[model samples]
Target: MGSSASKAALAATTEEPMEPGPKHLADLTQYINETHMSVAHLADILSKKTGSSSWVVVFKALVTVHHLMVHGNERFIRHLAARHSLFTLHNFLDKSVGEGYAMSIFIRRYSRYLNERSLAYRQIACDITKVKRGASGVMRNMDTDRLLHTLPVIQTQLDALLSFAADPDELRNGIVRAAFRLLLKDSLRLFAAYNEGMLNLLGKYFDMRRSQCRESLELYAKFLARTAKLTRFLRVAEQVGIDRNSIPHLTQAPCSLLEALQQHLASLEEKKDFLCPCGLQHTVTLSIPYRPTGNACARRTWFADYFPYTIFTLPSPQACWSRAAKYGASIETDASGGTNWQLSTCASTSAIWTSVSGPPSPHTVTSTMAFPPLMSPQSLVSSPPGLMADELELTAWAGQQSQSM
Candidate 1:
């Protein structure tokens, strides 16, 4: 009996766990319907509370409907298309064309209005309260009054302009095409505006040298990267009968702004004299016990140690020549008629050497470093193991250096 019980327990332990099954189509349909009802109910409550003249309710309803249409299942979408005659109307028809154009204009104006109001609201919110002693004059109290007074007025005006019905009769007429067009246009404009606003804010913060700008920039970049993935999902939506092309083209302003900011920040970071918040300038320190010579191997070894944390290709022959020329060094004949060369320190050379060595000190001695003659790329590649091992050592050293940093 004991042996049999143990066998059963082992069998139970070895059994594969059951995975959750996919949701049933009926359950999904019910869920979508319930969500739609919830949004509709919320809109109704808002409309009653703020009055039928409030645009806030209308806007919320429109956004909810657009979300449902965009993300809804095929059955619900097909029902909508058929019920609304969305794609059946010909653009050549005078009524259809006129309504479509009117819808586009209305949407554009609405988007502009929203943008202006949002900016105004932000400004007002920032400056509504002055520093004061009284309880009534407190910032929080002032904000509450601002919200109470401003929101109802804005909502009323907005609602009067574009009142949304729970069951929109506009959808049954030729206006459905116009409605879809407006939805798509508005969505694109809002997205563009959001990106533009972020770009402007980032620029402002960066100009002020605010530390918070870094976090904001990173978050914005991450959002953009995630948005790129949405394109694939949109393609799938198109396959399921939604007209993805009806959406307006995304503006490149945000991407361009991000790229420019990234490049600017990178350049700032690379500067050796860039000041940190601690009130000290950043500098690379290289300590070499041996003096630099004309030999390529010695120079390569020095560089390998100098840039311990970075992996970079060895300077080409032309680059070496350029550096030498910048330092006013040249090959010439000596008084004894023998080949001779002299090197002097230039700004670039001094900066480079300073970065490699420790911070400047009173006792620091300046020595004349020899510049190596330009060698072909092939010779640099075919150097001895001792010289070649510098590159290998660099790979290992770089990892360790990075960990420490």
Candidate 2:
């Protein structure tokens, strides 16, 4: 050979690309599409292969499904029946059990996808749960495509995924961070939608075969706890493959994952007795009387529901005082009769004694020894402080005139 021919021959032998056959080329796509029909087609192909007697066929099918599922044209989903494809995909996952170890790998891959998709409904799970019950027959019928035996097989698939799931490597696979977030969202949904079926599903993965369910829970707990160290809520849904807003509620069963989560979160939020509105700490003192009466007497206990930036004026401070006096006002009490937050401090002995010293103003004092000024509720509602001051001054002046008479 000539020198040029020799160099060309060496280059061809060393760097030649293996020409992919037509079948292999058919299975591979350069760009992943997110179309529903394409995804369904890919899944159907996978299901058929998963049921195949040949391991190579099953493996190739799984590769094809994974490729299409992740990289398929997302826009195609608009034209596809999302619900139908999910059901079909889930069905394939169910039958994967009989397909052996390779099948298990495919199921695990599908589980990752499921985990991702489930996360998409994080914000709307409750809304979906509301519509979950009383769904149309068509919706219910869709899930019934497979027999119970085939359907329940997904629990095992989930179990296998848990077994093989690793701590998503952040170095090479920083995608695990997103996975963690998606898993966290899934955990929330599982807690919210915790029905017998889902609980059983979680139980299967946690108790029956592998410990990864428990491990993931622990890892998530640690992650969330660490999140508490930071003030802002973070978004990690896409990492885990969840939509965070795609929760679809097809029915409303009593024991759904949404219900469980709602109950759990309700209990948690209720346990918080205090709220710092401005994220600042300040003290508020309230005094309760020994025998509160009238409107004030009707008042039981006061607790701050929300913080007020400034003090609000009451229509009748005396009415409040009369209520407080009934209880023989105590400084130690943290609460008073009104729901409105009011700042209080103990009155000096002189302030109390001075009011009582000349109080032979019999007409102004009621039989209960509290102010009995004849101010109507309407007048109290209208003028408030001015009306109250006028009433008190008139009462004192009337008493002095009566003394002179």
Candidate 3:
């Protein structure tokens, strides 16, 4: 039975006329859902197909995997998330023809997207996900600590999805091909989910005066860097003949919020007291139990046996925004029990914090061979409600299909 499914997958992907088409894709998906052995056998076949030198095989194999992800059952998803998964299409390449060469680029991008999508899903299945989805179908008002762990992963997925725009010419060459059409639709759903996720996270930091935090600021900067990337992506979309109106998510990405975030980041960077050496590289001070000498300071710079608890230098002045280190005026208490502030006698040996600009991202994504000037309710793919995965749960139950590989 396993061998049968493997052979069927190979034939459907390699021997089919043109693309596998919907019939074959549905048949293949059924095979994945049949049994554990069938799932493993099918996965092994796909890994081989995608890794082949033949571009057609790679494209068919990738499409099959994408279909399985969307339409197959849970077994396949777990198979992918297992410690050892089958496909290693990340560095896949094909040099058979001009179209293959061009298509190879998107193949790599797609593979990376799949790999990231799988891992993020695994994070949720494992309950290791820091951010959880809210009722509005997007990640919002997340715990700050969890955002630190989850935000970067979200950015990475966004970058992978947006990067599909990197070489539109190659894809343009495949525009008439089915793989192009399939990926285009898949990318649309992806854009809607990820773009909404990025925006909601930005919403967390929308009010700088109230929501200011080093972690949130870092997130804003990360998304801000993609400004240029977004521009390139849109250019490719226009070149591919996609109807802008048909795809509101791609066309109406949260640029205004990104700009607002950038403005806030820049404003902070511009402040004289915003950044300093001590923030990144602070002096090592002794804990309360250690002697107050050489890299050691009293808890209050306590006097008597060690030093007085009330009289001590405030932390040296450092960036006001830096959350990692504390450097400011010395804090001490006088006889009346009132606190007094003074400048720190000690200083950092070197300066650290400096201006570094985030690279811009073009909202690079393509859709359908030719999106109608306007889409109807039925024409639009309803992104699954589960795609709201705890916000960073990323794509909700987006990884609906999972089989053992």
Candidate 4:
């Protein structure tokens, strides 16, 4: 069959118009409102018009619906889901990590334009995303999946925006198009941290393969590296006053980490300030492991350990500590029984406790006192859920290191 006829037939079956224009938009609005069709219906419509398969149609429909939501078309969003099972509506939308990435890029894009009123729409879009899941029945959290999904969209948008280099307004907003580019750069720094977390979480029903893990890691690194080529375009966006905060931090983890890796990179280093890779040259906070060499009366100085952990903001400190405490408790006892001397030591050197059951293991106990100004017992007490991994690691290491010393 010829492509156009096939596409038309597909759209006819699903009941969506094939072209972009006023009538097309109006018909889609009416179809969504009046029929409340499921994702399968939307996919069928898209496949018929585009000669693409049901999968592509469904994916495109998700992006379209998300765009509508961002544009404050709640009537459209509600109309579609109200008619169909929301889970069935979302099944095709969440097929792969790339679809998620594309939708997220659009969200992050329009989210930049959100005022307080539009934030409601943004929240609704986020809430609706919970409907889909993997075969294991584990639904991916929006925060965790946001970047993974948005990266592909960011690339697609960037390519489209590049086609409009002649138009300054489109050119200016191109930073929105290039959102994940910075992440493609400096992939190693983020990947190192990412790997540590994955390794820690691997056995917990994640269903990750080594190849998938490596591909994911490489994709992330490439995104970080590509940011450089797009910098000039981004600078133009900033001149027009785009809100950088709309998107989550590309340089740091969207969530928190457990083992304080003893590496510290300042917030500015996070591809946010200047650029990537070279951005690492910016001032970084370093933590070195130290062991006391002198007697009880002697003054001890912290010695440098080659291993480093970069610190970033953590959303929840107490929760992290609680979880860490739980994990520690699972393997051993409270272990908080001995002298409190570790309190005065630098965050890097805090590893005093050894499991007395056998040979001295390398397991170290760190706390959350290292952050000089940003994170304190006072601050740690206040963080919301979804802890920032870097900040938690820094605070935990600092607190633990002090006690060890």
lDDT of 4 by residue, 111-150 (tens): 2322211232233443222222222211222233443443
List the candidate 3 regions with Cα displacement exceeding 4 Å: 1-4, 15-17, 33-38, 83-86, 89-100, 124-138, 166-169, 172-186, 195-212, 225-245, 249-405
Q: Return the TM-score for each candidate structure.
A: 0.24, 0.24, 0.53, 0.29
Candidate lDDT scores, in order, read 0.29, 0.27, 0.45, 0.29
The number of clashing residue pairs in each candidate reads 6, 43, 44, 48
Off by over 4 Å in 2: 1-43, 53-56, 76-99, 102-405
Report the C-alpha displacement of residue 10, candidate 1, in angstroms.
62
After TM-score superposition, the amount by which residue 112's alpha carbon in candidate 3 deviates from its true location, in angstroms, is 2.8
RMSD of 3: 17.9
* lDDT for each residue of candidate 3 in 1-405, tens digit (9 for 90 to 100): 666666668766873436675666777777777765537667777877776887677777877776787667866766777736655776766766666666677777777777776786676452122223434643444444555566666666657656666555555443224444444444444443434445455444433343444566556445434433443454455556665433222111111222223334455454323322111111211122222222112311212222111111112122211211122212222444332212122211111122211222122321101000111112112321001122222233323211210
Predicted structure 2: lDDT: 0.27
Q: Which residue pairs show backbone clashes in model 1?
A: 54-155, 54-159, 55-155, 55-159, 286-356, 286-357
Error of 2 at 44 (Å): 3.7
Model 2's TM-score against the true structure: 0.24
At residue 166, what lDDT does model 4 achieve? 23
What lDDT score is found at residue 189 in candidate 1? Answer: 28
For candidate 3, what is the TM-score?
0.53
